[model samples]
Structures are given as structure tokens and as C-alpha cells.
Target: MKNMKISRRKMLIRSACLTIGSLFIPISYATAVNGNRHLSKGLDLIHKVLSRPLDVSISHLNKCLSSGKIDLENHEGFKDYINSLITVFNGHHHGEDEILFPTFEEKIKGADFSKLKKQHKEIHPIAEKIKDKINVTDPSFDNYEEIRNLLQKMNDLWIEHRDEEEGIVELDMEPLISSKEQIELNDKLSKHGRDMSEPANLILPFLIYNLEGSDRDTFTDDMPWILKNFVVPIIWKSKWEKMKPFLLA
Candidate 1:
């Protein structure tokens, strides 16, 4: 009976996770920090702007590279395309490492900001190496195999870096981000629309899921602006409409 109960609970939990994940907008959990909520929204907005298009473009380029069906000269057209995505990605990480992370570390001492910063240092060189490899070079160095290897390395490094930043290091913002600070940050972030929105949507969901009873209520109630204006419409509802098929698949 105990085993059956555990199995049933696991199934129910999986169902809940799927339901929540499919909805698009992140639900408010207790322990949701207003400032972190704001930051999450900003991050999600920025990520959507950077990732989706880059993934599509890279997929096409990778396929062409594999088949030898596309000319390297044609890859030149995608230079700007690739660069645009890289610029936004770098800018987002730069803001986190330089602006957001420092502020939080200063406010809440004893947190392992150094470790996160170190990850940034390690990940950036890999990113730069990929960028260098992708740039059109001399014919003597030409080899599709080398390019393929670079792409694999770049992709692997990127996935690992994201997991570390988003997972390994738990950013305890409860002590740092006061309600007042969140409002101030929101006011400042109003300038960048799409760039800000991508990151917000991406992180907010994860943040919401992590929060518990009271913290969750406080975070959501205090930041109704997110639900009414941003989260509900621009993110969750929009995602539900668009991403439902993918989720079901």
C-alpha cells in the first residue's frame, strides 16, 4: 500500500509539472521575491529574443554544413544573423554578472557570488572560441570536420553553462531584493521591451515553482503588474496558444 501510494503521488506530481510547464505563464508560489520576479521576467524576455531565432537559424546552417549542400559564402549572410543573437546573449549575461549579481552579493553577503563569477570566466572563452571558429577564415584552414567539432563544443559548453548558472548556484535573493527595490528595477527596465521580456518569462516560471506557501503569495500579490500586464498576456497565455502542440508532442 505504501509503495502504491508513492507511485500514485509520483504520477500526480509529474502530471502537475507537465500542466504547469505547458501553461506558458509561471504560477506564483510562496517565497517569490518581487525583485527576483522582476529579474526573472526580464531574463525570460531577453532569452526568447535570443534563443528561438538563433536555434532555427543554426539548425538550417548545421544541416547545410552536414550535407555539403550550402556554400560557405552563403554562411556570410548569416554572420549578422548569428552576431545579433550573440550580442543579445552576451548583453544579458553581462547584465547579470556585472549589474544584477554584484548588487545582490553586496546586499546579501556570505553568498557564493565568486563561484558564479568564476563560471562566467570559464564559459566566456569557450563562447569566444566558437565565435572565432565560425568567422570566415583562409582556405588553407578549411575543413568541415573542424567546424562541426567547434559547433559541438560550443553547444555543449553553452548547455552546461546555462545549467550551472540557473541550477548549481542557488541565488538567495530573499534578503536582498526588497519590494521597493523591485519597483525601482521595474521602472528602470521599462525602457527595453522585447529584450527585457524574454528573460522575465524564462526565469519567472522556474522561480515560481521553487517558492513555497507564504513567500509565493507575497511575491504574487505584491507584483500584480507581472500577472496582469506581462505574465498572463505576453508570456503564459501567449505560450499556451503557441506552445501547446509542442508540449503535447
Candidate 2:
């Protein structure tokens, strides 16, 4: 009877220690011990995929143009840059019109979604004219006269449109679209945890290329999460391969 009681007590004590150890063990270790894949492990990949790099690209282009200090030779690869920019801008505007604006218009009956739509119609033609000009001036051909005129006009018009849309239309539609809240929810859905790699990749490269001295430092410091996981595994080593002759000129 004494021997059986002692054995039972030993068994109970061992079970209690196992339970206590499990309670104190970290979730990551427990997952590893069980040979289970952690669902939370790949959150960084999703964040990198969903993160928007276009805005930073656009801002860098604008800064380069404004400063008149762009190394055009290095950026020859960006022969498609202007067109890409316009396409992206138009698409974003269209998204706001189709998805964001309608819902907003319903809530704010007095809001001028139509007016904004009309403004797009007015702005797009001017942009189209400029794009048409820019498209023709390829690598071999520098139709400096027509290109310069259109570019200057487009820049002025774009700034005005950006101000009106970003300041007036976007400001008013905040409540209806709830863009801030939606963006936050989307960010959370993008990743279970914040990614630390992006700040060193896309954002830093863009800033370093475009900005200099204090301005560059400020941008980098302020936006540390711009390119969380943008490691370029493949490199385009040949510069000559990237360059193409403009036969149109």
C-alpha cells in the first residue's frame, strides 16, 4: 500500500511539472516542438506584396523634374516612365470614381462627385495631348521644342488638379468613403505584424537616387518602412541591353 501511494505521488508530480512547463513555454517553441507550421510566419511576404511603391516613385520623379538635376543617362531605362505615371494616375482616379466615389456620393448627397468626374474629363484631354507629344520624342529623337511646351503645361495643370482633388474633393469625401479607416483595416489585413525590410529596400533606393544631403536623410528617417522586402534577387547587369534605338526619330 505504501509503495503504491509513493508511485502515484511521483506520477502526479511529473504530470504537474509537464503542465506547468507547457504553460510557461512560448508559442513559437510549442509550435516547433509539435512540428507544426506557424500561420503567422509569412505575414511579411503579404505585406511586401500589398505595399504601394508607385506613390514614392511618382514623388521622386516630380522632385527630379523640379530640381532639373536628373541623370538622364542613368534613367534611360525609364523611357516608359511618363506613360506609366499617367496610366497609374488615371487608373487611381478611375478607382475612386467607380468604387470610392459612388458610395461616398450616396452618403453625402450635396457632395460634388459629378463635378469631380467632370474635372477628370476636362483634365484628361490636356494630359492626353501632352502624353501624345512625349511619346513621339524617343531616344534617338529629341523634339525639344514641342516636348518642352507640353511638359511645362502638363506640370502646371497637374499641380492644380492635384491640389484641388487632394485638398477639396478628398477632404470632403473623408466621412463618406472613410478612406483613412479603410486604409488602416487594409494595412492590418496586409500583415499580422510590421515588416522591417522595406525601409531599406524600395524607399531608401528611391530617396537616395532622387534626394541629396539633409532632404534625403529626412525622407529616409521619416519613412522607414517604404520597402520592407524588396530584395532584388535578379540583377540586370548589362546597360547596353536596356538601351534601345528610337527608329521613329
Each model's Cα RMSD: 15.1, 19.1
Cα distance off (Å), candidate 2, residue 93? 1.5
Clashes of each: 26, 3
Candidate 1: what lDDT? 0.47
lDDT of 1 by residue, 198-223 (tens): 33433343334233455444444544
Best by TM-score: 1
Model 2 residue 78 CA deviation (Å) reads 4.4
Give the per-residue lDDT of model 2 (tens digit) for 186-244. 23322311121121222222222333444333322322232212211111112122222
Task: Choose the strongest candidate by lDDT.
Answer: 1
TM-score of each: 0.51, 0.45
